[model samples]
Target: MEKEHKHHISSYFAHGTVLVTLLVLTVITVVVAGLKLGPLSVFVALIIASIKGTTVLTYFMHLKYDKPIYRIMVFGVFLLFALIIGITFIDYVFR
Candidate 1:
């Protein structure tokens, strides 16, 4: 017996909104790059990039409509990645 998969169809307006939001984020990234924030600039850029990546994953990739377990797994993976990066950053700072 095969289980039926329910498809979540996103509206055109919603996609358009997402596109506009991404464009706005890109603009913000450009603006941030032009500023001389020094060490904080990289952190800010990473934050913005993360937001953009999440937006793409959630809407464009239809991860938002996936099962809860899948979402939790993705979150865990991201957390692990962050932890590794944090550790690497700490090591670099101390060296």
Candidate 2:
């Protein structure tokens, strides 16, 4: 017989908290977009987006309670994406 692994169930309060945080972040993003900070607006938007993405991945996607391998894979993918973006920017700058 195989042993079944029990999953951790998140509370409604936790989900609500995440939802509220995402909503707040959305408002902040909109406010930042209205500021017209030139290049800095994009950077601020990206940072806020990253935070919202991480929150969704951790809570709604249940990545926080997932196995180590899954977390590692997600982190690797994020790292790869960041590296690609960095390289693209560098190429653009040098051209």
Candidate 3:
């Protein structure tokens, strides 16, 4: 007989908290966008977006309770994407 694995169940409060945090972040993003910081506006937006994405991935996606391998894979993908974006930015700058 195979042993059944138990999954970690997140509480309703935790989900509510995450939802509130995401909502607050969304408001901040909108406020930042309205600031008209020129080139910095995009950078600020990206930073805020990345934070929101991480929060969603960690809590809502249940990555926080997953195995270490899954975390590593997600991080690797994020890094690869960042690297590609960096390279593209560099190419654009040089052009």
Question: Residue-wise lDDT of candidate 3 within 38-86, one digit each (tens)?
Answer: 9999999999999999999999899999887789999999999989999
Question: Which residue pairs does candidate 1 place in steric collision?
Answer: none
Q: What Cα-based lDDT does every candidate model obtain?
A: 0.92, 0.95, 0.93
Candidate 3 local lDDT, residue 67: 81
Clash number for model 2? 0
- Give per-residue lDDT, candidate 2, residue 61: 93
Candidate 3: the clashing residue pairs are none
Best by lDDT: 2
* Per-prediction TM-score: 0.87, 0.90, 0.90
Which regions of candidate 2 deviate over 4 angstroms? 1-4
Candidate 3 lDDT score at position 25:
93
lDDT of 2 by residue, 1-95 (tens): 65567898999999999999999999999999999999999999999999999999999999999887788999999999989999999989999
lDDT of 1 by residue, 16-44 (tens): 99999999999999999999899999989
